[model samples]
Target chain A: MAIYSYDGTFMGLMSLIGFLEDKQINPVAICDKNDLVTDLFEEQEDIKTDEKRARELIGRIVDHICEPAFDRIVYGFLSQINGFEMAIFNYLHLGLTAGENVERLAGDRRVAPLRRLSLRVGREVHRLKGFVRFAQLADGVYYAQIRPDHDVLPLLAPHFVQRFADQHWVLHDLNRSRAAMYDTHQCEIVILAAADSLCFAENESHFRDSWRRYFQTIAIAERKNRRLQQQFMPRRYWPYLTEMAERVR
Target chain B: MILADSAKYDVSCASSGTFRQGRANTLGNATYSGICHSFAADGRCISLLKILMTNICIYDCRYCINRRSNDIRRTLFTPAEIADLTIGFYRRNYIEGLFLSSGIVKSPNDTMELFIHTLKLLRHRYRFNGYIHVKIIPGASAELVHQIGFLADRLSVNIELPSRQSLAKLAPDKTKESIIVPMRQMAGEIEMYKMEKKKYRHSPNFSPSGQSTQMIIAATPESDYDILRLSEHLYRKMNLKRVYYSAYVAVNHDALLPANPRPQLIREHRLYQADWLLRFYGYQSHEIVSESHPQLSENYDPKVNWALHHLDFFPIEIHSADYEDLLRVPGIGMRSAQKIVFHRRAANLSRQDLRRLGIVYKRAQHFITINGRFEGGQSSLLHSLLSERKIERARQLHFDFNDAPSAVQPSITGEL
Candidate 1:
């Protein structure tokens, strides 16, 4: 069985899709070069990042199919993280094999694993944005700690730049111990320990008091479903939710 | 995972289309803007990023997707990752806000620590001022739920099942004691926040958006009436934000559990209608179902059914019926009923006016009178009218389910 590999990018996955469309070849698996590699398939095809090829492939899919579906297939391929390039190749192989009656033919057996991957990646990306809580350091630099599902810190810097375009802050993806520090003048990624990172602002407590109070007020009590609550806002995440610490022992 | 996680929070609990704006650019347009899908794995849908801090579990519930014995792939995120991702998605406008949930990875304290770290990082670290909803891990120490209430825009915990016996059968690791105690603790703190806010302007309010919970349907033998009755009590007693219904999917096969996939979408749909009636419409759980009425008709909606059961109230003159009377009319939803009240202040409404107000005169005409005249022929024909209405509703719901992208949802706990 042949292994189709990519340069571990979105376009790379598309190029593989292009290959599946034109040929009847069914690659046994897809893998990404970034994660650990397996010795199952000795033969590997790298979907080179050709600007023209990638564009034409994506355009072809969009011209005929849903753009989001095409994107999902690519992202689903990425979520494999391990042997992703191989998975993408297989997924595309299965998708192309289904051809027109695609959704019906593939069903849960092929579609679920891929969609689940895209969803997993998308959900983690969204949750980290909400759960990443920062505190003030003595140096006037804002510092925060987080433990993420993936090595997501690298994928998250541009957003901080866009949102807090004017502010100075430090966001440490605590799981990886690497941080993105946006100083007023420049932004750099840094790493720090939980012990060395404790710092505060003059009104840090005051600001938290306001935030904590606000958090308490908005939730409608008439709808308290603990299981639903735990499913979304799991207990493990409480350490990072403020106010819990405010009244902390 | 976000779909799975939506089961954790009630805020993202919607399953329909938004108001239809023409596709200025796209091919199709939803009448409603923010209806999401249900969890197929759990029959919950909504465009919510439902996920866990970590999937490791201390208590293995038999019905849960993240239970310990299940070998489903598990993952956890750093606070930075949760915060960063939320902002990025928010900017992309793919989501409304963050709905953060986690499995107990370690001790309750340790688990809560990570939760706070992520929420704080999202707020303080990322400076992400957006919709953030979190859960009050029930077993954590006292100050935990109290503090969580302060940080979270909305807070919640799951009832899981309606009764303690059911929960015990499927989820031995969880206890009503551990669950209800923290929930009560958070409720008290939030209530106190309101009290303090009035007295001391400086006192911060806790859980400002409020708290909500989900009850898993089909996990137990609890009937719709039983669920609605329980929902009524929760709403009145707990002052809950929303009582979410997560139709149970058989995640594990246990002797104590059935492989119930979910309330068929219709069942889920009916419950939502029943829930809306309880919350918005002036209908009591008893008015819809009782010891005499053990279940919703499933054929006619609870409202029409209510109208059928009580004929004395029918032929209610549009110009004469009070707000409560007008609310009882089939096809006259809360919005329509409110519209009628406002419109009637200027002029006396007639049968023509009810049709103009977007009230489905087909279902309501039999039960309501216009000024002094009732246009709906006879009460006997009303029976067929009721059954026909059921067919129409089923068709609409089917069209809704069929038209919606199936890859993202199943037709149960959620869809939008």
Candidate 2:
């Protein structure tokens, strides 16, 4: 399987699909590998930044395929952080094989990567449904922060922005070094001083304290599934869970 | 002819329903204002003000975070605070509406009362008419439920588990009663309003947009078959708008729940896929699941699974299969199924033409043939292919992004 590399952005990935259209060369599989390895002779390659190539890909996609199809394939590659080349190829292959008959092609084998990514992100969003915490800044920014595995910050912003849009708020995605900052008119990205610049509000600690106590009280010891718990919320995220840390101590 | 389909949808993304559309000189994220800067799967924008009313819940459902015993940060929002916040958001156009769910604080009625009050203040006092989706606590009093409908646009009560036995084991505080009673009553109220409006031409609308419910899968062993049965009942009996299947994730290491938090999303996907069948496909749960496979098939979708299990339904002459029979084919979805029905009315359909009607040749080819030309896979497929269904748990996602994998990793308590 030859791995293809792109600029590692959504548009760049789309541009790669543009390459596929331009050359009709569908690579073995497509994905965006954060860690790119150039296998000198093991693979035939293309770097997708040329404007002409990018335009062709976008043009072919919009003209032939529906707009929604590209969105999923691109988001899947980004979310799973899958092999971008494979991800791209699989997406195009699924679309071409299925063509305008998009709905029926929903669960085809080729599109499994994207479907899995959707389900994975779906589960994470549900888990974090309860985990999002707000820290009232000294300056009254009402800052909340998260460090999700995928670039979930972009995914999660609309929820908080809609809920907290009335107030100036900053939801910092520390992993990607960006924040979804909702101002008076629009929400944009901001980089914090560090995670430390943010502080819990006057009532925030009380809330966290209450939450810690609540978390400890709910578990049925006999039903404890450490492995299952670890699997859903990798122990990595525990550092930021108020209740879990308090209970451990 | 593969129409190039690249997929992207961050699952954690929600399109905001903040009603920020008509705010005058005031900052507000429109109730539906979370302008889906990006549309995720299910074909909706990925912008919405999604959050809980407060994380403080008196009910300790084993699957939930707001439960009393869960060691998580908890917060409470006063009506004034939420109203002020919503107005600020409305001015800014940051969201569409508020998705506020809460733990059972004090009692179901109390929590529901608080939620209703917050919504009321957002509406009457602040004169805000954005989208407000309040959680109707399952065991909440009838009056509270009624008041909630009057205040909010959409109300939902999560049917967290499929069966009562499962609910008791994992979410001890919740029962089938605590969950379904409100749904039943809310359904009645909605029907009442619908009837009154139909007859009198005008009446107080109760949940005009209607009620919705959610189920947590993989928290218990109820098969997708069973889950679909419950969903079918909720749809038919409860008259729900949507029955959301939130794949279960392990927030706590609850012995009663799955040891791992990752939900069987393929199962969840199968359920949703089946759900579309029931709601739109003119099929029933019993039609899909049987004594043979009480649980849904892990490999293929319910439709494809059904088509494969019963070859008799196969090759329904694409040219002759009635609209309903056409739908029975594995790869034919709502659009394609209808397309074939419509196009065939005009002329005789052909094998080459099935693809034009939107049938995925691989999955549908065997089950359907336009000119009696079969395109089924040659392989005797084994059980469903299992790509890692390892759901990323709450443990990983619910953290301070600032808590990097460094010496400065913040403690799990959401502290700096």
Candidate 3:
């Protein structure tokens, strides 16, 4: 069987898996179109993203398997970790054959890898939910910039939308160069390179300073454990945290 | 900064158990699973904007930094100032919400009135729907307590010291009756409101997140038995959502208080671990500690210690044992026990399968047997192996503050 490649979009990956299952061909490897190589020793086939096919496969997974299984697949794909595509394909292959029993096989090697990757993405999403700090922009829109490990913008969008329904806010994932913009009525994800030009509001610094003071004073002096503090709130995330970040200008 | 500094000693920063969705006009909302916006230098979760309304006091609580005898700077924030600060910080996602605590200024009734006014400003004028944790001052009238319950998400009245004698020594002004009265009143009101909501849909919630209280540990001569037994009583009788144990940090020099008292974090950690057992695990106060063993072992965790003492309960056949039985095992947790039960119904589980299900096989191997094949060497060996990990961990990671095997927590979810 030839190696299969598809567009990197989640829909494209689903379509590729659906096409492979239908053809009864076990591909050596499944990869994104960008990563596909024209090897002289091996043959490669490129598949286009099919919306209907992807929807049908997702519907079947939800019906035959469980919604949580489908959620695992989506989250695993979002992880963008190394060789995640193949791991997800294997998970899906087992899930399709085993039906809902695939969940019971959480200990199974094929299923466990996907579960691990999905949990990694889930944890990062959970962390960024609290880690993401928004500063009021000069235009009165709340702006936050993050560089999370996974492509968790889509997962983080619904939470911020529900929590900040009446306010205008933008959650910018600097790692992926994508932003989720919300304007009270609607929320949309768009590609944005940088937000260096935007200025913070006049009172933003004052509030930030107060938060910094609160953060410093809240800690018990005798119970000072910098190691433990760094363990919970890692040094990598300190750059963007309002309390941890150093004053600019 | 002054208000926050005075309020820093309060360890209850939980913002969980209340779900208030954002409305058209509201400034914020509460999440059922609380969010920690930041972590402090002491490895504590910075969930709420913990601050006092005022630090000026009429009483002399020896352990408190805001005691009347202290020569420290005292400050007070107007109700409008607190409301503005809460909204300002909330809009920037700097905090979960306001954690309004105050020292006794004039009387508990006057202080409670001020709290109610501040809460009203946040709830009505500002239209803030987020989590608000209010400190219910002891000796406050039931009328004032009833009114404030409707405005806040969670209410707590700090017990401060463990025993009545300790209360007398450390906080003479705070009588046992004064504290328990508000707690009992709030618990009854919460239960009544929960019942009322079933009958009338629009019935407002009376502290939707329920009530929690805190007690300072290690300052007095109270044993682990004394603290845990009191916690059990509070949980059963008052129906408290949580009982926080703050390690005594000596900020005051008093003959009654411990001299140069360092915050007993390890003891505090062990108490929290035992607290989890009491709340989540089906362990009673007597089961954990008794007159014979008043103090918890500094070496092993409460669970491990329990497993070691009860030898006959070990060698539980994984295939035959139920969920509750599995929970008693050294390595098996609630999540892992559930997985074992679920998986064994479909197919036979192997040793490797148990490991995959998130069980600490090294710890659990002694307690459980797979298909009647015991891998645990002997009773004496089981005891050593169970505590070996904690011993090794203590030696290697001395700075690791949390008793949990996992990484330190950023949010106080009140989990085991």
On DockQ, the leading prediction is: 3
Off by over 4 Å in 3: A247-249, B379-416
> Per-residue lDDT tens digits of candidate 3, residues A1-249?
888898999999999999988987788888898977788877889999999999999999999999999999999999999889999999999889899888888778789899999999999888888898999989999999999999999999988887777799999999989999999888999999995587989999899888888888888888898888888888888889988877221
Model 1 steric clash total: 140
Candidate 2 residue A217 Cα shift, in angstroms, is 24
RMSD of 2: 15.4
Error of 3 at B1 (Å): 0.2
How well is each residue in A29-113 modelled by candidate 1, as lDDT tens digits? 6666565366754786666767677788767555554566676665565354555454445555555445433333222345545
Question: What's the number of clashes in each of the models?
Answer: 140, 109, 0
Residue-level lDDT tens digits of model 3 in B1-416: 98898898888989999988787756778888999878888888988999898999999998888899999888889999999999998888888899999988889999999999999998888888889999999899999999999999999998988899999988989899999999999999999999999999999999999999999989899999999999999999999999999888888888888875567877888899899889878899898889988988666689887876676677799999978889888888888888899889866888899988889888788788999998765434433443666657676867343333231132123331
lDDT of 1 by residue, B1-416 (tens): 43234234343543122222222111112212232311122323334445567777777888776778887666767777667656544433234456777788788878888878887776566555545577666588886666666666678887888888888888888888887887777777778788998999788757766678887777688888788998998888888768877555555678778755443546666888899898988678988788865766556567766665566667788776888888888778777888777767645666655665678887777777777777774533344444656557767777442322232232133331
- Tens-place lDDT per residue, model 2, A189-221, is 666645544454565565444433323333333
> Candidate 1: deviation at residue B354, Å?
2.3
- Predicted model with the maximum TM-score: 3
Residue A237 in candidate 2 has what lDDT?
54
DockQ of 3: 0.66
Ten consecutive residues with minimal summed lDDT in candidate 1 chain B? Answer: B22-31
lDDT of 3 at B316: 96
